[model samples]
Target chain A: MLYLVGLGLHDEKDVTVRGMEAIKGSERVYLEAYTSILGVGKERLDAFYGKDIVVADRDMVEMDSDEILRDADKVDVAFLVVGDPFGATTHADLLLRADALSIPYTVIHNASVMNAVGALGLALYNYGQTVSIPFFTDSWRPDSWLERVRENMRLGLHTLCLLDIKVKEQSEENLARGRKIYEPPRYMSVPTAISQLLSLLEDSSPSASSDSSPSLASADSLDPSTTLAISASRVGAPSQRFVAGTLAELSELDEEAFGGPLHSFVIVGRRFHALERDFAGRWAVDRERWNEVSNTVYAVRD
Target chain B: MLYLVGLGLHDEKDVTVRGMEAIKGSERVYLEAYTSILGVGKERLDAFYGKDIVVADRDMVEMDSDEILRDADKVDVAFLVVGDPFGATTHADLLLRADALSIPYTVIHNASVMNAVGALGLALYNYGQTVSIPFFTDSWRPDSWLERVRENMRLGLHTLCLLDIKVKEQSEENLARGRKIYEPPRYMSVPTAISQLLSLLEDSSPSASSDSSPSLASADSLDPSTTLAISASRVGAPSQRFVAGTLAELSELDEEAFGGPLHSFVIVGRRFHALERDFAGRWAVDRERWNEVSNTVYAVRD
Candidate 1:
């Protein structure tokens, strides 16, 4: 049996009792490390579970999954993911491989950013298609996510933007030289995500547009200064912090304002319920501004 | 301090170690009983946690919230939720009340239906706004959710329909007589939700249309016979089951096929990715029909 367990957001202790039991019964345990990171290290998890874990990077999981699933038909092989097993499509592929090999599997679910974002006081049901913001390179700036956010905004639906995390990424120079070296892991901070969003807005604004780059339609719906937004850092952790304000204000925030990495951003929709607005106001960067925009721009659905 | 801990979908063992620690340290432990239910009963949780829990029904949580928050400012109090603490808006209100009483609080996240639905091989990001399906009555047959589902289908995004669960509900006769009598709890089954959905389609169809009830726009996007759907039961439990098929076929399924209550329905959107289609095929009621619909109706985005 292949046991896919989720180490819910936070430290080693966040794993459910069932997940712990599964780990204890497993002969070999593999921790999926590329997708997301837990608050604590492998040492803490090892000490807590009394089992040594083998870290599975993207290459190993994608290319050498058979090794991970080896003898699973006869023995229990535990594969641990930072969030829920199904949070990423990559894990689904692994499950498919297990199916093809006729290896039975059990999924132990846990909280991921998809539901943990509810901690910000936004109703989960009100959220539309979630978008992911990747680390933009100088030459490879992708603004397609902006269109998704705009579509969500047009429908009066909230948008949860999952910031990118680059783990064990090979640099261009290292790849070119065929070196087996990796750059340090980089997790996008809330401020960095806001900066990228602001950059996208500027690049698509009519004032900054050239003939080569057409201006985006309905771009005004996501004005940085007026649109209400929320930034969450280290969600589901003891030190989790949520800051609500305009995108421009959030962009100006420093790491001191929101400690740690693994941040997420939410663009509040126009159809904000009165209760939602009230709950979100507790974390506002500027209380008066939050009220003004919420009252004037947003349509209260209550 | 007030601790809002999520008891992830399942039995007593599904609670995280952190949540257990909180419950152990808590002077008063309150299990939220109205929003959703765990697979196990209070006695099992009491034995596991070694603490007798005070079940907080709707009235206790809503009308008498102050009673729940009493003395939280001085001693530790844990409020347990079946899924994620923030899955329901009512919990947010409790937190707000806590804030009003100057009680600092912490949230322990866990898997909710919103994220657990991903186990059905659909990406969480692909889902749009979620809709709730209530147990329809002769006079109170609300069909506003059909429009929301239609809107999601129009945007090619999956819609997760949360079936309503009625707990401690009073019948109209009992309420009218000012009696404290309560009706037995009723949970909407998968088939009931599908039946209601099909009824909505028929009610809005041109053939069944009347002058009083106007036809819905873009109703064809959610055809019962062709549109793909997935039904999930006892999700996150060891006995969790998922069945995928057309809405019509799923509606005809009996309780034996899907063993328990607390069922959720998903209406697949047209923008189904190739990988999602392939994964969903594993649970299809009719493999040939699933493939034909995938090829003809759903736009494959690879």
Candidate 2:
């Protein structure tokens, strides 16, 4: 039997009781680490579960999944994911492989940013397709997510932008030299994501330099100064932080307050209800500033 | 502090270890009962946790939230939700009230059907805005969800149709008579939802009776015979069942196999990847029929 368990977004104790039971009964446990990072380390999880977990990198999970599911037909083998097992396609692929091998599997679900982002007070139903914003480089800058954001905005739906995190990645120089040296892990912060978005929007504007082609046709519709947005850091954690304001205000927020790793950004849509605005106001870094933007955007009722 | 913990989708053991701790340390624990139903009863949870729990219906949580939060600042109060704390807007509202009252709170995240639907092998990112289909009555038949389905289909995004569940609801006569009488709980089965959808579609067709006006402008975009869909019953439960096929094929599925309660439906969009098609094919009630529909819709990449 293959047990696909989700370690919910925080400490080791966030794993469901059923998941814990599955881990206890499993002969071998593998934690898929490339997709997302947890607040705690493997040693902490090991201490909590009273068993050592084999860390499965991208290569092992994507290329050699058979090894993870080896003898699963005979005994229980646990495959752990940071968020919900199906949040990423790779995890789903794990299930696919298990199915093809005639291995019975059980999925234990946990809270993921896909649903946890509702903490920012936006109705879950009001959210459209979620988009991931990757780090932009000089040579490989992509603006594909811009279209997704625009589609949500066009429909008056909130858009949850998942920031990119590069873990166990090798540098170009190291890769070229056939070196196994890896670069430090990098997690995109809200301010960094906002700056990248601003640059992209500016470059796409009609008044920008002639060499700069618009990445999105509806670029004119988004105004950074007036468009309300929310940024959350370390969601589902004890130290979770949320700041609600305009894109411009959020871009200039205090980094010391937001602190380290795992930040999510939400672009508020035009169809804001009075209740949503009221709820968002409670999380504002500057209540006065948030209300100013909210007044301009939200159609608040008495 | 107030602890809003999620009881992840299965039995009593589905609660996270952290959630259990919260409940253990809580002076008062109230389970929100109206938004979603859990597979287990209060007695089961009480027996597992060795703690007494008070069930908070919609009235208590929505109208008398202050009562639930009474002395919360002075004591450790646990408000348990079936899925993720923020899966429903009412839970978010509770957070708002708590915030307004300056009460500190912690959210324990758990798996929600929003992400758990990935069991069908569909990517979570590929799903668009979720729609809720309510039980249609003679005078209260609503087709608003049809517009949502149309928009998602237009964008080539999968749509998760959340079937409505009526619990502890009062009849109009009971309400007007100032009586506390409640109606028996009614959970919409997949077949019932599909039949209602089919009827709505047929009624809106131009070829139908002259008195019937088409609610959908692009009525031709959706065809029941060719559109692929998936239905799952008792998701996240030990006895969970999944059936995938074209809309027409699923509309006639046997209810005995689905059995008891808690069912969800999904409408496959136009842009299905080959991997998605292959994965979804595994749950097909009729593989040959599913493949026939898939080949016409999916852009297979081999």
- iRMSD of all candidate structures: 1.3, 1.3
Overall lDDT per candidate, in order of appearance: 0.86, 0.84
TM-score of chain A of 1: 0.94
Q: What DockQ, between 0 and 1, does each candidate earn?
A: 0.67, 0.68
The CA lDDT at B262 in model 2 is 91
CAPRI accuracy category, model 1 = medium
Residue-level lDDT for A36 in candidate 1 = 90
Model 1: per-residue Cα lDDT over B112-161, one tens digit each: 99898989888887888999998898799988888888888888789999
Q: After TM-score superposition, what is the CA distance of residue B112 in candidate 1 from its true location, in Å?
A: 0.8
List pairs with backbone clashes in candidate 1. Answer: none
Residue A37 accuracy (lDDT) in model 2: 86
Candidate 1: where is the Cα deviation over 4 Å?
A207-220, B207-220
TM for candidate 1 is: 0.95
Model 2 per-residue lDDT tens digits across residues A272-299: 7777788888778788877766664554
Q: Write the per-residue lDDT of candidate 2 for residues B67-162, one digit (tens) a residue.
A: 889888999999999988888653667887887898988888898888788778888887889999999998988998988888888887889998
User: Candidate 2: which stretches are off by over 4 Å?
Assistant: A207-220, B207-220
lDDT of 1 at B66: 88
